[model samples]
Structure formats: structure tokens, C-alpha cells
Target: MTKTDLRHRDVAEAAASQPMLQQVERWSAINSGSANLAGLATMAGLLADAFSALPGELALLDGAPSERVSASGQVLETLHGRHLRLRVRPDASRRMLFTGHMDTVYPADHSFQSISPIMDGRLNGPGVADMKGGLAVLLAALSAIERSGAAGSIGYDVLINSDEEVGSPSSAALLADLAPTKIAALTYEPALPDGTLAGARGGSGNFSILVRGRSAHAGRNPADGRNAVVAAADLTLRLAGVASPGLSVNPAKIDGGGPNNVVPDTAVLRVNFRPAGEEDVRHARTAVEAAAASVARDHDVAVEVHGGFGRPPKPVDPAAEKLFALVRECGRMIDLDVRWRSTGGVCDGNNIAACGVPVVDTMGVRGGAIHSPDEYLIVESLAERAMLSALAICRIADGGLA
Candidate 1:
């Protein structure tokens, strides 16, 4: 290896020994579930403190107004907790974006709150592999880069949002606002169980269709009442028929049914759709709107649809492929084999890619059972992936990824 390669390996090895798990343990102890505003605030503060060691102007940004339809058929605006931002050398010749989510899928009352060793070299917890571990790796990698005296060569913005678990409805604008300035992005989503990465990702959308109808007593004047529950059921089944080769539709739940003595006047259909590409996105939207209109007309109920596809499909284009190649090279330098495959899951990477920036998102620790109570992190990968990311950043700073 050359002198510079030897220097990178030394930095990687040094970063590998950092106290990554200590931070992961501390972070996983907090319950920063998507809907838990207070918990998210706590996590944000903790993250701000941890990330303050980096050189940058760090600030907390308010979340956008995210709309949702409540069970009462009333549209409500929900605000997410503050998201942390760190901007360094905004005018540098090369700019990069790094992102991670502070929220997990577990609620505040969830029973799985602490980390414990589950196997010979793995620890399981609520957010261990889903992303808290990833955040630890990100900090270690950036710290290594700074220590190696290459921090000034690149400009980067790190965004830690708190609502990715529920689909980043509030932080989507933040990702977009910083996308145009970035040539590439690295999102610290957990790597797959085998340490493989995700390349292209399918687009996802969550929707709630509210159906309004007249309520009447079940035993009397029932014929005069338009049952919104039945209308919602019909719409749900119709939505299933909209599924095809490139699109999957899931009608998750139907809310708003009351006592059996009365005809239900209001119902809401909660649906999720995944599109394989841009055309599928348009097709799915058109089909959903048309089906809602048809069901409303047939059942004599007024239907109001809320929510749209927030994440667009992410394709590994030429630019993204180049970055992947650089990461693979970095992995080889560290004696780690790196590979990637397409995934159906979506994240902030989709939004970043939509702005014409290349992103390699799953650069975190390796483990299995993400977003579950059994979520785990491989102890060895905590250091291994941190070294990988630090080397990647160093390579980028040296004009290798550019």
C-alpha cells in the first residue's frame, strides 16, 4: 500500500477502537418513537450534544406541519420534534450530505427499552440495529476524518431527523432544501444482516381516506342511512384490485365504526402503496383517487383523501454507481467485501436522490430483525463499519470519489 493508503488504514484502525457501543447503548435507552414528541425532544438534545464535537454550525430546526386524518374524520396537523443540523464549510469545492434518523419504531411504553447480549457477538434492543448504532458509526467516521487533517477539503451537512419511522413527512422539506448543494450523500441506515447494502429502493406512500355518511338507528330507518363503514370496506377491496406486477397495495385498517345499534356514519381507510418506479407512482395515485370517487358515488358517501406518496423510487443511476464503486474500493482497502442489492424499503435517500444527488444510504452496523423487538447489532461491525465509512470519507476527500 502507498503512504496515503497506510495513513487511511491507521485512522480506520484507530476509529475502530472508539467507544461506539457505549454511545449506542446510551442512545437506545431513550424511547424516541415517531409519535412520541417528548421522547423525540430528548433524543434530539442528546444527539445535539454528541454531534457537537464535530466542527460546524449546529442548530435545531422546527419540523413542518404534517397532516393526518384522525378517527373522528377531522384533519389534524402534527408537528415533529426538532431535527439536528450541522453545516461545515458550506462553500467548499466538494459538498456531501450525511443523514440519519433519531426515531425508532418502538413507542414510549414499549417493553424493549434496554440493550442486552443476545448471542456470541450481538446485542439486541429497540433501536440497536435500526439506527442508533448507525449514528454512532457516523460520529466515529467523521471524527476520524477530522483527525486525519482532511476535513477542510469537503463540505458536509449532517441532518438527524426524528420522524423517519413514520415516513419523514415532516423532515422531507429539510432533505430537499439541502439536496441541491450536495454532489453525494451517505445515510447511515443499518446494513442488511449479511452486511450487504441497498441500492435501488421502491417508493412508498401512506394514505387515509375518510368516508362520511348519514347515521341512523340500526333497528329503525336503517335504509335511509348511508353506512360509511360499508363504503370504506368496498373501497378497501377495490384498492386491492389496483395491485399489479409493479405495484403493491395494502389496505391496512378501517376506523370509525361505532356501536352495533347505529349505522356507522364515518369510516376511514388506512392504506399503504409501494411503486416500483415513477410510472407506477403515477398509476397508483390515479387508481386510488378513481377508486375513492367510485366508491363514494356508489355508496352515497362523501370521500376525502389525505396524504400522498412522500418517498419517490431511488434508482442506482450512473452517478450513484460511481459512488458505490468508490465505496467498494474503500471496503477492499480495509479487507472488507462490500455488495449491494435492490430493496423495497424507502428512506430519506429517496428524497436526496430525487434532487439529483447520489446516495449510499445503508452504511451502518450489521445485524438482523430491524424495526422489531428483536433488533440486534453485531458487536464486531460497530468498529468494522465505522472504519469502512471513515475510509470512504477519506477517499472522497482525497479526490477518489469525485
Candidate 2:
């Protein structure tokens, strides 16, 4: 076993000796969806209270950034809330930001709100992997960093946003604001079942295309009516892999239709594109616009596409690679052969990377099936990650790990 490996293991053990699991269970009990106004407020309050209990500078990021919340298949409502960004110390230069989202895919009234024991080693719960457990790890890791005589070494910041599950529409600006000054960032997103994590992510854009057309009787005067669904279908077919350059075009839903007797006057096509690179994003956006224009022109209907790229892809930056190497070295120092990889899943890391900050995601506890009721976090990796975080912070803080 390497020295860094042994040190990481010891630090992990030390962190585990604290009330880590208890804290995880505590946070896991809450359902904080981005759109759940009351729940989000409660969670923000809980986090503020928890951080206040600790010895750091804690405050609500009221001015950080926020937005109106919207749900799937529903009109948007005006709801204002912000992510919590805290800095333990302000004097150090080489800094790191640790980010986690309090939001989950599950709604406030979902039936699977209750956590259940699935097996000997797994506890299935909403947001357990998609990341309430990861938040627990973040808090615990920061706590250990403070307690392990390494507090304030690297001038770290922790940003816990409330809207990562819905593509981080509201929190992206806040993340970018916090990113420019930091040397690196560590995001608390759950690792895969085997503890692998994102090395590359596709930039995602969610679009709603609304088509306006004239309605008429289908059987009696089909030619007089414009079938918006048909037009939308045409648009969908055309948009599917239009550029095919590391971009995926997926048409998820068709809305605003009528019964069998009448031609649909309006159609809304929910289209989302994931681009493998930033250039792919630009190309995809142009293609979507062209496809929308072509459809509108051919069908003599007006179409509007709403929404843009929320977060860009976190390509394997050299700094990110360095941070990952440091984590791997820390793992070796602790005697654990860490398993990790890159992926196309988007997270708060995307927002951080958009800020031009180097980052290593999957710094949260190891887990699987995030954003699902079958979500589970590993019982062991909590401490491992905490330890790795501590060492990374210490090494980076103490003069370039030399």
C-alpha cells in the first residue's frame, strides 16, 4: 500500500467515526425537488442550519441566482429560491469548490417518498444516489477537512444548489460566478455502481417547439385543416441526427392535440439535444433552428422553439485531469484501487466547468441508479471520498504537492 493510500484510508476511517451515516439518513428523509417550493425552502433552511452549526461562514445565497419553477406538462409558476454557497476560509489562493444539488427527480407528492431497505447492503430511496447521500458526503468531507488539521488550507467553497435535476436552469449562473476564482472544483455527484464517474459530458439543451396551425374537421374537410402533429412529426424526423456529429436529437413528447374527428390546431414537440462537445452544441442549435424554419415554411405554420443550453459539456480539461490524477494518487496512498471513468451525464459539474474552473466530479459517495427510487449509496465509499478530499485539499494547499 502506498503512503497516500494509507493516509486516505486512515482519514476515511476517521471521517466514518463521526456521525456521517446518521447525517446521511437525516438528509435523505427530506424530499427537495427544484419545483417543490415549500420543500426547497425547508431544505435550504436545513442546510443553513446545519452549516451554521459548523464553524464556517454560512449565508443564504439570496443574490446568488434563482428562477421560477416549472414542472413537466404544467404551466410555470413564479418561485424564487437560491443555492447555498459557503466558503470556509477566504485567505488561501489555490482553492476548490465543492458543489451538490439538493433537488431530486422525485416530486413532493411522489408515492416512493418513503425509503425502503432493498437488500442486505442497499437502501432504496429517491435522491439517495442522485444525490442527498452525496450531499451528506460533502458535508462530512468538509467537516473532516476542517477537523483533520487541514482546515482553511485551500480556501474551499461549497455550493449546494437547489435545481440540478432539472438541468440546473436557475443555478448555472451562480455556479459560473463561483468558478472563476477557484483552482479546482469537486462536485458531489454519485459514482456509478462500480464507482466510476464522468470524464466527459454532453452539453444538453431542452427545447419546446410550438406549432400554430388552422384546425378543421378531419373526415369532412381534411384538406382545409393543417395537421400540426404531422408538421411536428416532419420536424422531428428532420431534426433526428441532422448533423450526426456527436449530437443526439430526441423528440420526447407531442402535446396540444385533439380528438379523432378534428385536425389538431396546435402541437408542441418537446425536443432535447445532447451534444458531445461545445462545437456540437452550436451545430445542433443551428440545425434545430433550420429544421424548425423548414417545417414552418413547408406547413405554412408558425413555430417557436424555446430553451437553450443550460450547461455545457465538461470535457476532460488538463486541470480536471490533474485533479483526477491527484485523487487517484490519494487513493493509492490509501491502498484502494479506485475505479473511475467519464460519462455523458450532466450535473452541477457542467455548470462549474462552464465557469472555467477545473473540477473532479463523483467526489460524492459511490452509488447507483441516481434519480430513481432504486437509488442507493455505498456504505463504505463515504469515508473513502472524504479522505481523498482532505488529502487533495491538503496537498494542493501545501505547495503544489511537491
lDDT of each: 0.91, 0.74
Q: Please, what is the TM-score per model? A: 0.97, 0.90
**Backbone clashes per model, in order?**
0, 10
Q: Over all chains combined, what TM-score does candidate 1 have?
A: 0.97
The deviation in Å at residue 271 for candidate 1 is 0.6
Q: Name the top lDDT candidate.
A: 1
lDDT by residue (tens digit), candidate 2, 209-295? 878788899899989988888998899888885747688888888777769998987888888888888889889888988999999
Candidate 2 yields a Cα-based lDDT of 0.74
Show where candidate 1 strays beyond 4 Å.
none
Please list the Cα RMSD from the true structure of every candidate, rounded to 1 decimal place: 1.2, 3.0
